[model samples]
Target: MTALIEAESVKRYYSNASWLQRLLFLGGSEIQAVDGVTLRIEKGEIVGLVGESGCGKTTLGWLLAGLEQPTEGAVRFKGRSLGNIDAETRKKVQLLFQYPRESLNPRHNVRTILSYPIRKMGHTATADITARIHSLLEAVGLSARYADRYSFQLSGGELQRVALARTLALEPEFIVCDEPTSAVDMNVKVQILKLLSDISREKGISLLFISHDLSAVRFIADRICVMYLGKIVEQAPAQQLFDHPCHPYTMALLDAIADIDPNAIRKASLHGQPPSPMAPPAGCRFHPRCAYTEQVGTICWERGPALQPLSTDHLVRCFLYPEVSQDPDRKQ
Candidate 1:
């Protein structure tokens, strides 16, 4: 399978505001929002990215969507490097933000919002924009009557559908969905997730679905990537990941979910907030909070682990599997 999107050692950093404040008083430090991270998504497949708040999931999504550029490394789409692509090619990869209310223009009606992208693309005639809007409205489970409605006139779910319609207007081959259903009601969230799945199946569009909701990811993703700090600690088939999570961080996350079966024994919860990305912990970024840290050693503190294959499809970055390590002395 060909990768529709790939990120190689991507990194994004933000200098602390204290630098400015330092002019008045000495204090504060910089922040590394997204550190070295790499991932890939095959065509027509959905890959879910999950982590706690401020874990750089949204930043990774934006990078994949081309809304933001990486400070280091490269992002490639459809066999072509993103940096080499023209604007026309870039439009084929779209991003859907989390907050529909903030993403949509309050003053613009639904029709205008949907038609804006169509017109900008120069792909349709002005006379046909209204018809296209109606078709899109229906495609996303919205009523044609809402075409003339303003952003505030509709409910949260309705606004999200409108946003989806606008994204569809571009006819993108790949989409980075950043927490698409997080702000909506549970019923609406289910509808939105089903709608996304249906659209992906029907259109063969590849998706990088970013969310902190593990349960939702289980339902929609073919594969899962568990991120910690600024790095991916585990990647595996969705079912395999949930059933036999290899990374300690991944297991901690599943344990933290409240709805797990009562008969199943729970793993210990991850304690303490993740360390600052600016100076991420040495070896394993997750070692500090991991209950399985007993298996890690000084090497996990002095050197970072590379992603290594566990099973045919599962890949994890941890010293627990020393057989995959490059160091002969460390090889199990």
Candidate 2:
């Protein structure tokens, strides 16, 4: 398939201070929400972006979806710079935020909420808009009757269904789904994940699914990218990464998840909060929290390791991986 979106060395930094602080002439550091990250999504694919909270997954999503501008670097859609694309062209990419309740407007019913985006884009007339709304509701497994209910009246799952419907109402070619299942119940989460998977296959829509839920990603993604401190630490096919994780951070994340059997050995190998991104460690951002990192590692501390390609597709950024660390030319 063709490339739908590409983020070339993307970096999005936000001021640490509030607007009031800046107005008062306060001095504050910057939060590197997305720092020097490069990624690509192909047409008709689901790429899972997994990381801890504040690891730049959502920020990168917004950049890809054209919702947030990158402080540095560029995002390209179908080989066209995102900055150059007009609103109408950019709407081909959509962002599905984490919280459905917060995403919806309380005053509007589902019908009005779904109709507005289609109307704003001027895609359909009054007669076709209502039919489109009904189909969207049904596509998400929600009945057409729920269209008249306000957001507050619906359950979390129902509300999320409405949110998905709203995003689909636009019939976007690509979607950046930020923790779409994070706020839903366990059963509902599975249902939603399955629904998304089905939709991607049925509609040939590309998606960048961002979440900390590794298990969910393992189930739903074609490829997985692990992020840490605003950088992509590893990129591999889901099962391969799980089967032979090269990076220490990736290994730790695998261990963090509870397997099917409750009797399986469970342990938390990584400790200490990630160091502040505003003042990240000079070398590998994950070095401080890596249990495998030892005192003899000067390269891991003095200089940042490059992203090494273990195979044609699998990539890791760690000094321990001699392929990347020993040879500087290898790039993923």
Candidate 3:
């Protein structure tokens, strides 16, 4: 079967210099926010995109959700290109931003906020809109009483639920949930994760859960993709990834979530910061911080390795896997 959403060799870049500078042939650096990423999300599958901040997770999410266009490649929904998709088709793909407070209009009450999407996305009568708003609130675990309350009246978790309800109001089939749980407390975070998981299961909504939190991603994602400096370094089944991480960056991210123990022999310890996207490192972007660089030798520095399959399902982009087949941009 065809994937529900596919980003094939997608690339999104930004120029740091003005248009006039480019017109004058003046030199300006290009920031490659997402560089040659090929990803696929099957129907009803929650694919977790895990990486540190500035790794281009949110930028990729924006591209997949059709909020921003890619400089090259294509984002296809089902079997059709997103660019060619009609406005009605576009409504099937929605984005839930990192911050609910910013997404929700401060002046708008809950009823008004939920009703706007229903009215705009399709023609609905005032009475039907009210009924739909109440239904949506209940779907996200919110009560009918919240209809009159503004964003300020809700807690962080409550606000996130409202934001989710708004997204659901569009009746989306695929949602790019960009760091939806980042702002909430631990208890509230668990609740939100459960809510997303439940919603996906019940509604069969394919989700790209982009987050820096490994534990949260592990809880909700069916498959996990580890990103580094605008590229996906590794991807695998969630249980397989957490149990046997192949890439050094993936190891480091998983290690970060573990309890600190001085005596523990960590699989990989990340040092220094990620390189700037404006000018990423020559070879593997994670090479500078990777622990196996010395053992793997100059290959890790001289060339970037293809994302080769370690097992049938797990793929890793590191020279340490010498026996894996050569398929640079192959999709699973």
Return the TM-score for each candidate structure. 0.91, 0.91, 0.96
The order of the candidates by lDDT, greatest first, is 3, 2, 1
lDDT of 2: 0.87
The residue-by-residue lDDT of candidate 1 on 1-332, one tens digit each, is: 65788998888876665656878775466566677777888878999999999889999899888877898888999778897798888888998889999989999998788888878768478668888888889999988899899999989898889999999998899999999999999999999999998999899999989999998899999999988877788999999999998888888898889854777776677888888877877677877887766756677777777877898899888878865536543221
Candidate 3 regions with alpha-carbon error over 4 angstroms: 121-123, 260-262, 323-332
Per-residue lDDT of model 2, residues 75-155, tens digit only? 999899999897777788888889999999999999889988878767578788888888889999998899899999999
lDDT of each: 0.85, 0.87, 0.90
State the lDDT at 107 in candidate 3. 98
Task: State each model's C-alpha RMSD to the native.
Answer: 3.4, 3.0, 1.9
Q: Per-prediction count of colliding residue pairs? A: 1, 0, 0
* TM-score: model 1 vs. ground truth: 0.91
Candidate 3, position 2, lDDT: 87
Clashing pairs in 3: none
Question: Candidate 2 vs candidate 3: which has greater lDDT?
Answer: 3
List pairs with backbone clashes in candidate 1. Answer: 283-300
